[model samples]
Target: MRGVRGATTVEANCREDIFRRTTELVQAMAAENCIASEDIGAVIFSSTPDLDAAFPAAAAREMGWAEVPLFGTQEIASADGVARCIRVLILWNTDKGQGEIRHIYLHGAAVLRKDIAGN
Candidate 1:
């Protein structure tokens, strides 16, 4: 199994923004890796402590990803860590090597993974 990492930031702490941004990040992760929901073993989401208006997993379920296992948690607070950030780790069943996997970081979260975000 391979881990497909992705992170995105919501402009505001609202349900609409959370859903939209989460969906965008997940879609990009799937598209970039050329995988479907069935190819995913599980999806884990972490939101910075400041973001609690909505759960990112709800956005995944709203995306018709009913069969995929989903979990959500709040990230440990850090003075220098990015805020209003949502991160996702998708456990996938694939033959792709670690170096070949694509990790997506969009919006403000891009600063968290500068090496792989814009690539």
Candidate 2:
């Protein structure tokens, strides 16, 4: 098993923005890891307190992940935490080693995982 991490930031707390950014983040993670919907055991998403317009999992469903186990949560409130951020942790059934997994961080969320963000 391997876990893929990804995160992205939105400009505002709107449904369209949330869906767009979350979709982009999830798609990037899948592409980078070469993951398929069937290989994904579960996906957990977290969003900063400021973002409450939509659940990130909704975007996954729109992307055709209807049967994949998905969950959503709120990030701990912090004064300096990234705003309008959505983070995802995908549990995948794969033989790949942890070091081989790719972690995606896009937009302003890249700063949250600078060491592994690759950009």
| lDDT tens digits by residue: candidate 1, 1-119 | 99999999999999999999999999999999998999899999999999999999999999999999999999999999998999999999999999999999999999998888776
Measure candidate 2: CA RMSD.
0.9
* Cα lDDT over the full model 2: 0.94
- Candidate 1 pairs with clashing backbones: none
Candidate 1 wrong stretches, greater than 4 Å: none
TM-scores, each model vs. reference = 0.98, 0.97
Instruction: Give the Cα lDDT of each candidate.
Output: 0.95, 0.94
Give each prediction's root-mean-square deviation over alpha carbons.
Answer: 0.6, 0.9
